[model samples]
Target: MKAMVTTGARQMVVREVECPRPASGQVQVKLEYCGICGSDVHYYKDGKVGDHVLDHDIVLGHEVAGMVSEVGEGVTDLKVGDRVALEPGIACGKCIFCKSGHYNLCREMKFFADPPTPGALQEYVVHPADLCFKLPENVSSMEGALVEPLSVGLHAAGTGDVKLGQNVLILGTGCIGLVTLLACKARGAAKIVVVDLYDKRLEFAKKLGATHVINAKKEDVKKRVDEIFNGEGADVVLETAGSVITIAQTPFLTKAGGTIVIVGQSAQSEVSYNFSEVIVKELTIKSIFRYRNSYPVAIAAISSGAIDVKQIVTHEFSFEDSKMGFDTVIEDAENVVKAVIKF
Candidate 1:
């Protein structure tokens, strides 16, 4: 098996490594596609995401899907030929959070590509069979890889409790932002407004079902949002841009008694926000770490034609050109919505 290792910032090399075999209750998957996430780009470009710095060589991929090549003992549900998406985070099932069905908050989670845990950027990765959700014949392997990020969107919309005929304001046009738009649209949001600096990404958002698109670079965000929402503000405001400015703009953009979901992780920890606006409006503020219990829902939504996850892909690269893929994502951030490595 071959693995793409990140030796340093913006440095990557292919190395022939030992193939991992599945242990008990696990399955060995022949990886087909691995999506490059924002965090992956952060690690590749700056060698860190907040405090989680890259101290050593690491494989940089977590959103992945593949076919099962071998099933270990006690793995009964998945067979050798089953196509599945591996949920990247493996939590310690005994924690209070895990027991309470909040496994994404489990303190002892060994998530793939999170520092010490090696990611699934190689040819073969052995994952727990229970974490591998089998994909239906109607869903492609590429869509399977997307389930991971789609889960975040599902979780965000579900947290905000976006209902039919409700209005939503997503503050970003990145991959996560577009997926959140799809989630809000699938949940029957009447009006979806997306905000971003790049016109290309905003155009992509419009194609993905955003009723209104606002380029913050060209026009004022608060003014456009007010006009679009009839001076009321959105029922649900989701911050997916991961920008400090956008994060601070959430309270002002949310409607009175509405919900504000913080979906993006900002590089800076502390943000100056208007808590007075939150209190005055009686708005609800919620945030998600990653996602929990959303893979099945995302897969079902994709299968039912409620969400077209495949439309998010703007670029694709072969496994051998993985470095080039990462470079393109960094250099052409505005044009590339999502890039996947095909093995």
Candidate 2:
């Protein structure tokens, strides 16, 4: 088996590694596709994200889906031939957060491509059965690979409590932002506004049902959003850019008493936020980690064509050209919205 290994900063290569076998309550998946995530390129280029640094030569990919080649004992619902999406977070089921059904917030979680955990860039990965979700017959393996990111979008909408006929503002046009657009539309948001610096991504967002697209680089995001909302503001604001400025602007851009959900992970530990603006506006600010228990719903949405994630996939590479895929994404950030590695 071959895997993409990042031995050092700006260093990556395809190396032969032993195939992984399933442990108890786990299954070995013969990977068909793994989406090259932003974090993967971060680890490959800078060797770290915030405080989480690459410890060992890690295989870097988390958005994974494939067919089950082997199933361990006690795995009854899934069989050897089932195609499934692999949720990359392995949480300690007994933790307080896990016990409270917020498994994504579990303190003791081993997330793929985060640091030490070897991710799904390999030919075969042994994952816990509980996290392996079976794909519907109508869903393709490439679509399965997108469920991981789409789950984030669903969770963001759920956290913000978006509802029918609400005006929503998304402060980024990345994969998560676009998926959040789909989720909001599905939840009956009458007006969805997407903001980003990239014209291509904004155009893509408009085609995907966004009522308005704002180029933050050219137009005033807050003013434009105010105009869209008739001089008030959006009912719910989703910040997915992971920048300090965007995170700071969320409270002010949101309507009074509206909810602001932070979906993107910021690079800085202590972001200087405007607490006075939040207090004055009486806003509810919430943050999302990764997703929990959202994969199944995302799969159903993608299968039903409610979410067209396939269009977000702009580039695809074979497992052999994994390094090139990473490089291409890092170099062509604007042109490549989503990149995948097929085995």
Q: For each candidate, what is the lDDT?
A: 0.95, 0.89
The local lDDT score (0 to 100) that residue 7 gets in candidate 2 is 92
* Residue lDDT tens for model 2, 21-114: 8888999999999998888888899988878877778888999999999999889989999999999999999989999999888878999987
Q: Could you give the C-alpha RMSD of every candidate to the true structure, in order shown? A: 0.7, 1.3
TM-score for all models, in order of appearance:
0.99, 0.96
Taking all chains together, the TM-score of candidate 2 against the true structure is: 0.96
lDDT score of residue 172 within candidate 1: 92
Error (Å) of candidate 2 at residue 281 is: 2.3
Candidate 2, overall lDDT? 0.89
